[model samples]
Target chain A: MLDVIKSVLAAFFGVQSEANRQRDFQAASPWMFIVVGIALAAVFVLIVAGVAWLAAQ
Target chain B: MKRFALTGICFLLLAALMAGSTYAASINTSTGWNMPPGVTDVSREVYSLHMTIFWICVAISVVVFGAMFWSLFAYRKSKGAKSAHFHENTTVEVIWTAIPLVILIVMAVPATATLKKMYDTSNAEIDILVTGYQWRWRYEYLGEDVSFFSNMSTPRDQIQGLEEKGDNYLVEVDEPMVVPLGKKVRILLTANDVIHAWWVPDLAVKKDAIPGFINESWFLVNEPGIYRGQCAELCGRDHGFMPIEVKAVPQEEYDAWLASRRDAAVAEAAGADREWTMDELMERGAGVYNTYCAACHQPEGQGLPPVFPALAGVGMSVDPEQRAEHIAMVAYGKTGTAMPAFGDTLSPAEVASVITYERNAWGNDTGDMVQPSEIRDLLGK
Candidate 1:
C-alpha cells in the first residue's frame, strides 16, 4: 500500500521534474505565470462584482 | 498537510467574500429590475419565460454544484477516502437520465408556448411601417395621413464625449414613436440598407430589420410610460448614435398626438404650393439636411470617401436639368449602392428640404427650392 502511494506520487512529480530540467523551461519565465494569474484574478473579480450588482438591482 | 489545509481555507474564504459582496450589492436594486409595462402579449410572455429559465438555471446549478463540492470535501484523499469499484449500476444510470429528461420536458413546454405566442402578429389594431436608415428611424402609420423621420436629438458634442453627460445622453431623440395604451400595435420593420434590429428590452421585443425584406412584430402597452431602447444591431459607423424612445400614453393623448401629426403633414403639403423665400427654405433645409443627410454625406457636405459620392462641386449639384434626377436619386436611391431610397423613409417635405440644402450648399449656387408637391408627384410616378 505504501509502495503504491509512492509510485503515484512519483508519477505525478516525475513529469514535472523532467520538464523543469530542460533549459527550454527557462524561456517562459516566472513573471509570465504571475501576469497571467493576475489577469485571470482581475476578470474573476469583475465578473463577481457584476453579478452582485445585478442581484442588488 | 498544514499547507494543504491553509490553501483550502483560503479558497473557501475568498469564495465566501466574493459571494457575500455580490449578494449585498444585488439587494439594493431589486425593485428597479422589474419588467416595464408590457404592451404586447408576446413581450409579457417573454419576460415570464426569461424569469422562469433564470430561476431554473439557478436551482440546477445549486443542486449540482452543491452535491459536487460536498463529495469533493467528504471524499478527499487526506480524509482516507476509498474508491468504490461498483461501476456499472444500470438503475442509477437510468434514474439520472430520466430525471434530466423530465426537467427538459418541463422547460420545453413553456418555451414552446412562448415562441408560438411571439409569432402571432396578425389582426393587429394598428400597423406602422418602421424603416431603419443609417442613423435614424422613419415611421409611417399605414392608411393614416401621418409619417415622420426621427433622429438623435443629442448634440454632436455629447456624442463625442466632449460635453458632460446630459440627462438623456445617447437616449435622446428628436421624435419618439407615440402609441396608445391598450391597443395592439403591429410594427412592420425593414431597413433601407444593410441590417438593423428594433429592440426595446423593457417591452421584451426585438425583431431584425433586414434590407429588401419585411419582418413583423407586435406589442400592446398596458400602462403609460416613457420607455427607451437602443438600436441592438451593429449596422454601421453611427450605430451607437441611434436610440429608440417610445411614449405609451392614454388613448386621449395619443389621439391628440395623431391630430397634431396630421395637421403638420397637411400644413407642410399646403406650404409646398406657395413660393417660398430662399431664407425660409435654407433655414428648414439646413435642419433637414443635418438630420437626414449628414450621417453619410457629412456635416461639411463632404461625403464619405470611396462609398458616398461627394456632393460639393458634383455635376448634379450645379446643373439645372439634373436637379430632378438628383431629387429622384435622393427619393428612390441608386440601386445596389449605399444610397438608400429616401422615398419611403422621408416625408415629401423632408425630401424637398434636403434636396434644397444639397443644391445650395458647398457653393453650388443652384438657388432652387424643390417643392414637396413636386416630390409627391415624383413619388406617384
Candidate 2:
C-alpha cells in the first residue's frame, strides 16, 4: 500500500523511477492507478478554484 | 584541431554577417518584448501580473534546466560515471509536487483578483455603443446626439504604389472616436454583421463585437492622446482596413468638440441636397469608393473576377444604357449578393458622387456628372 502511494506520488511529479513503476505494475491493480490519477487531477482543479475563491473574497 | 579552427573562423564570419543584417532590419524593441504598462491603474496591475508570471516561469525553467544540464555534463559516460540503483525518493517527489501547486496558487490568486477588477464595469461615467460593420466602425454616444461612421481614409494611389504612403497609412481613419480623459468609458460592443473584436493594446482592453450579442468592456485613459487599434478578429475581406482610433481629451474640451461635431453633422445633412459639379462629384466619389466600394471592387476597379466583377472598364455602371440598373444596385443593393445596399448607409449626395466617380474615373471616361437630387429621385425620397 505504501509502495502504491509512493508510485502515484512519483507519477504526479512526472519523475517516476523505472524500478518503482515496474514494481507498482506487478503488485498493484491497474484500476487502482487509474483511480488515483483521476483523483489527483480533480484535486488540482479544486485547488485552483478554491484559491481563486479565496482571492476573490 | 587546425580544421576545427578554420571552421570556427568561418562560423564567426557568418555570425557577423547575420548580425549586420539584423542591425539593418529596424525592429522597434523600445519597451522590451512585453505588453506596455498603460496609463491606467488596472493596466498597471495587469502588467505586474504578466511580469510576475513571466519571472516565475523563467525561475522554474532556470532551476529545472540547470539541474538537467549540470547532471548531463558532470556525470557523462565519457568521464567514466556509473549509474545509481536508486528507485525513488519520497522527500524529493513531495517537494517537487508541493512547490508547483503552491506556485500555481500564488499566480492564480492575483490573476483572479485582477480579472474581477477588469470585469466590474459598473459605475462608468460615459456609455458608448460601438457597432462593427463589414469594414467600418459606428460609434453612438448614449444620451447624446453624437454618432458617426468611422471609415478608412487611405487613398487608393498610396495603397497601389502610385503615391507615397503616409506615416499613419491604413492605421488612420476619417473620424476618431473621442472620449473624456480620466473617466471610465463603458463601451458596449456589438456587430451589425459578422463577429469582430475591438482592441486597444495600450488600454489592454479587447472584447468581441459579436452579432446579436452585446459584449461590454471599459477603459479609463489618464493621458490625453490618440490611441489606435484594429479589428483584431477576422470579420471578412476588408477586415484589415477597419482600424480604430480613440482620442482622449479633457472633459471641457471634449464637450466643445462634441458641440462642434453635432453642428458640423447638421450642416452636412442640410448640404446633402445641394448640386455637385463634375470636379466635386469626382473627388467625393473617389473617397466614397475607396472607403466603401474599393474592398470588393478593386481601387482601380479591376476587381477580383469570378466573384467580384471589375468596375473600371466593365460592369453595368460603365455603360450609359444600364445606368438605371447601376443606380438601383447602389441604392437598393443586389439580392442574394455580397453587394450591400447603400441607400440607408450613405447620404444621397454620397451615392451620387460614388456613381459619378465610378463612371468617369479608372479610364471609363463616361464623364457623367450626377446630382444628389437625381439619386434622391431614384430612391423616391
Candidate 3:
C-alpha cells in the first residue's frame, strides 16, 4: 500500500522512473493506484482552493 | 578544455544578447508592450499578476533554454563527446516536474486572489445596467432612472476618407457612461440581440453580454479620466464601429451630470407630445438615421441587400399607402430578421423623424411627415 502511494505520488508529479513504472505494471491489479490517484487529485484541488481562499482574505 | 572554453564564450555572448534585449524591453515596458497598470485597485493587482507571470516565464525560458544550448554546444559530436545512454532519469525528471509545479502554484495564488477581488461586486455605490445592442451600448443607471445610448461619434465622412480623421477617430463616442471616481461601480451586462463583450482595458473589466443572461463586472476608478475601449466581441456588421467611452468624474460632478440627464430625458419625453414641422423632422431624422440606421440601411438608403434590404425606392418608404406598415416595421422589427425593434431603444420623436427622413431623402420622396404624437399613440405609450 505504501509503495502504491509512492508510485501514485510520482505519477501525480509526472516524473515516475522506468523501474517504478515497471514495478507498478507488474502488480496483479491497478485498483490501488486508481483509488490513490483519485484521492490525491481531490486533495490537490482542496489544497489549491484553500490557498486561494486564504490569499483572497 | 579548448572546446569547453569556446562553448563558455558562446554562452557568455548569448547571455549578453539576452541582457541587451531585456534592457530594451524594460525601457519599453508600459509604452505599448506591457499591460497598463490601470486606474483601479483590482486592475493594478491584475497588472502586477500579469507582470509576475511574465517574469516567471522569462526566468523559466532562460534556465531551460540556457541548459539546452549549453549541452548542445559543449557536448557536440565533433568534439569527440559520446552520447550517454539514459532512459527515464529519475532525479532530473523529478527536479524538473517539482520546480514547475511550485511555479504554477505560486502563479495560481495571486491569480486566484485577483479573480476573487474582481468577482466581489458586493457593496457597490452605483449599479449600472450595461446592455449591448447590435453595434452600440446602452447604459442604464439602476434605481436612478437615467439611461442613454452611447454611439460612436466619429463621422462617416472620416470613415469614407472624405474628411481628415480626428485623433480619437473610431474610439470616440457620442455619450460616455459617467461614474464617480473612488466609488465602487458594478455593471450588470446583457445583450439585446447576439453576444457582445464589454471590455475596457484600463479598468481591467471584460465581461460578456449574452442575450437573455446577465454578466457582471465592476470597477472603482482612483482618478478622474476618460477611458476608451471597443466591443471585444464581434456582434454584427458594424462591430468595428461600436466603441465604449467611460468618464470618471468627481462625486459632485457625477451627481450633477445624472440630474441633467434626468432633466433631458424628461424634456425628450415631453417633446413627443407636441407638433413638429417637416423640416424639423427631416433634420432630426437625418441625424438619427446616420447614427442608428446608416450602418445597415446605409447613409443614402442603399442597403447591402440579401441581408439588409435597401430602403431607397419602390419599397415601404416610397409607397404612401405602406406608411403605417413602415412605421410598424421600425417600431417593432420584422421577426427572424436583423432588424431590431426600436420601440424600446428609440424615442417616439426619433422614430418619427427617422421614418420621415427615409421617405424624403435618397429620391424615395413620398412627401410625408410622420408626427411623434402619432407614433406615441401607435406604441400605446
TM-scores across all candidates? 0.73, 0.78, 0.93
- Regions more than 4 Å wrong, model 1: A1-57, B1-45, B82-88, B313-315, B318-325, B343-345, B362-381
**Which structure among the candidates has the greatest TM-score?**
3
Please identify which of the two predictions, 1 or 3, would achieve the higher DockQ against the true structure.
3
List the global CA lDDT of all models. Answer: 0.77, 0.83, 0.89
Q: Write the per-residue lDDT of candidate 3 for residues B1-381, one digit (tens) a residue.
A: 876897688688768877976885686545666667778898889888887787788778777887887788779899899988876678887787788789888898778777888999999989999999989999999999999999999988899899999989999999999999899999999999999999998899999999999988999998899998999998988899889999999999999999999999999888898999999999999999999998999888999887889999858889999998999999999999889889778889999999999999989889999999998888887
Candidate 2 error regions (>4 Å): A1-57, B1-32, B85-91, B154-165, B335-337, B363-370, B374-381
lDDT of 1 by residue, B102-142 (tens): 98879887887677666678789999999898888888899
DockQ of 1: 0.01
Per-residue lDDT of model 2, residues B36-145, tens digit only: 77767888899889868976886687578656766776688998999999757857876877899899989987898889988889999999999998899999999988
- Model 3 misplaced stretches (Cα beyond 4 Å): A35-57, B1-30
**lDDT minimum window of 10 residues, candidate 1 chain A:** A11-20
Best-to-worst DockQ order: 3, 2, 1
True contacts kept of each: 0.00, 0.36, 1.00
Candidate 2 iRMSD, 1 decimal: 3.2
Model 2's CAPRI class is acceptable
